[model samples]
Target: MDGTVDITMPAELEGTRAVVRSWLKSVGETVRRDEPLVELETDKVTTEVPAPADGVLLEILLERDAEAEPGALLGRLGARAAEPAAPTAEPEVCSRQSAAPAPPALEQVREHRLSPAVRRAVGQHGVDISVIRGTGRDGRITRADVDALVAARASAPASGSRIVPHDRMRRLIADNMLASVTTAPHVTAVFEADFSAIIAHRAKHKAAYERDGVSLTYTAYIVAACVAAMRAVPVINSRWHADHLEIFEDVNIGIGTALGDKGLVVPIVHRAQELSLQAIAARLHDLTARARSGQLKAADMKDGSFTISNHGVSGSLVATPIIIQQPQSAILGVGKLEKRVVVREVGGVDTIQIRPMAFVSLTIDHRVVDGHQTNAWLTAFVQALESFGD
Candidate 1:
């Protein structure tokens, strides 16, 4: 007298397929209709999948941190009554986990909660789970935990065969790279900017800025410059839609942050055009810290007008960064700041002096923008940084 209900993937998120970040309901747990059963996450968003009907969870079709496609069966819901199947309803059946599924080895079981990234890393690296010690909150396993185990084993000259599995993020990153390369015809433009004025400005006011409880950084300077440039050349803040182009009026900048081995996340600084330099610095600090902590919300990744990846933070001289290919036209990258000597006209005479400078690279969808517009945006950005006063 039991009937099965299927949980189908939502349509709007077809391109943005979901991954099981966490499973809230387990087998045999009775769930209410529309109750959240699992958490799904993409690179840009995370959301919950609701129950198909009021029933008991019979089986989880996928494991935690597994990839799910749109319209794919997430899990099975079993009802006590053999209710008549409604028209246009799809029958849910559990797919074979493997042709010959076997229970996992005892060593495969973990004693502590492992975050999705850690779990995926362990699977990919084929690390022995028994030796990993969790250092995260509540002794939860982290990516560092897995890496430490791998390093220790490697240093010990350990000899053991293991099969690892790639986590959902790695898989997603792979698919994303493929889709982006295939979909977007990318073009890049590089230019160097003099940061003498901005550096002097920071040196002159950084202490007072800190006194106001704000950390003054070159990032704030870049954000301010980007805001001015976007205002002057709005086309750089646009998106390409089929048959037409869509331009965003407000400027929200997405900052690419590397969370070490955990992975990369871009937390958007909302309404950046409306904030002062100090305010932008404060918010950038907050968003980046949260992003590194894996605490960013789904809404934080939504609606970015443009993106900035400060690759120079890691000492890169320059990088042709890949675009996030969102509802945006372009992404800008800032390289390492280094002191270089350049000629300047001083007192109507040529002079050679050292100045802190950086290379800026902009990657845009060339189909929507041209070289002139791209360079113009970069020119305005450089001008703003050079002209800002303390």
Candidate 2:
């Protein structure tokens, strides 16, 4: 007995209007249950749609580069055969000279081993499969490996001015950034933060954290502080609807990660208000590592109420009016940390001191967050950083 299964676009991809990047299987090809059958590329991420059951691919409703929406039928799968069928007729013999040439061993391997997406990429790039190395399981060539090769080839074009084509991710990022800047009346408030306490605490606890396989960084402290600040000024962690402002009870902090020319991705730390400093550090480390390796899931990039852009990692001193992540009312930017001389009154005597400091800026949607509220959040964030031990 045989049954047919409809392969539809996932519900999570409702709004992305993803395009069929590549099909990993062809009609008549055997497919295993849960095996990926196609690759979908959205503005935000690239994901695979897997088979519903062990079966043979019967049809492809949408071919490569076709646009798809949520619940759109992509293909059909035919139920597995119960048993091998006996030969119905004898084969006719042919002379060796009249026979068709056999496909190369590499081509044969690729047909069976590579996904439709990877195969399409390999063909489009005209890559010499014989020389390319595979990093996937059992030495299978993956889409990422092919993309990396394509990128490398395009890296040094003619040594002159060139027009670089933006990938889907880059184009989507640009569209979102433009939409954000245009939609929100961005207001920026800059504050000087004293990180001496945080620096001291991390220096003392860094070794212990390393022993536990986590690199305790300043961003962890900032995320903790952001949580505290959001508690104090909940409006900072809110979304702006046309009719009203929606404040969330839990803080979902989106940490902005740069992917070189590929643009940025913000993997959220859900319910951040409940996490301890160490837990936040561990989660951030995992998310960051996964993000860079293209292992982040769709859920990792959703429902972020607020965002933190730690531009300091790349030595940015200060960036004003950093566009707020859409719907979210505000985004915090941390600038480069540096030692600066400051005046302080010690026991009624004026004293000059050198302190580690960073400039923190909050870019808020003026419609939702007022100047007073912005100041309150920044004050709490700075206080948390400065009073680390306490």
- Candidate 1 lDDT over 203-320, as tens digits, reads 9988987888788888889999999999888998888889998888789898888866545767788888899989998998778766765566666776788889899999998887
* Clash totals in order: 2, 2
Error of 1 at 220 (Å): 1.7
Residue pairs whose backbone atoms clash in candidate 1: 123-164, 123-165
19-130, model 2: which lDDT tens digit per residue?
8876778898888989978878776567778898899999999987689977899999997766688888989988878979777786677667877667777789898776
- Per-candidate TM equals 0.70, 0.83
- Which candidate gets the maximum TM-score versus the true structure? 2
Q: In lDDT terms, which candidate is top? A: 2
* Error at 353, model 2, angstroms: 1.5
Superposed model 2: Cα runs more than 4 Å off:
11-17, 81-113, 116-125, 128-159
Whole-structure CA lDDT of model 2: 0.85
Q: In candidate 1, which residue ranges exceed 4 Å CA deviation?
A: 1-16, 22-25, 28-39, 44-139, 142-165
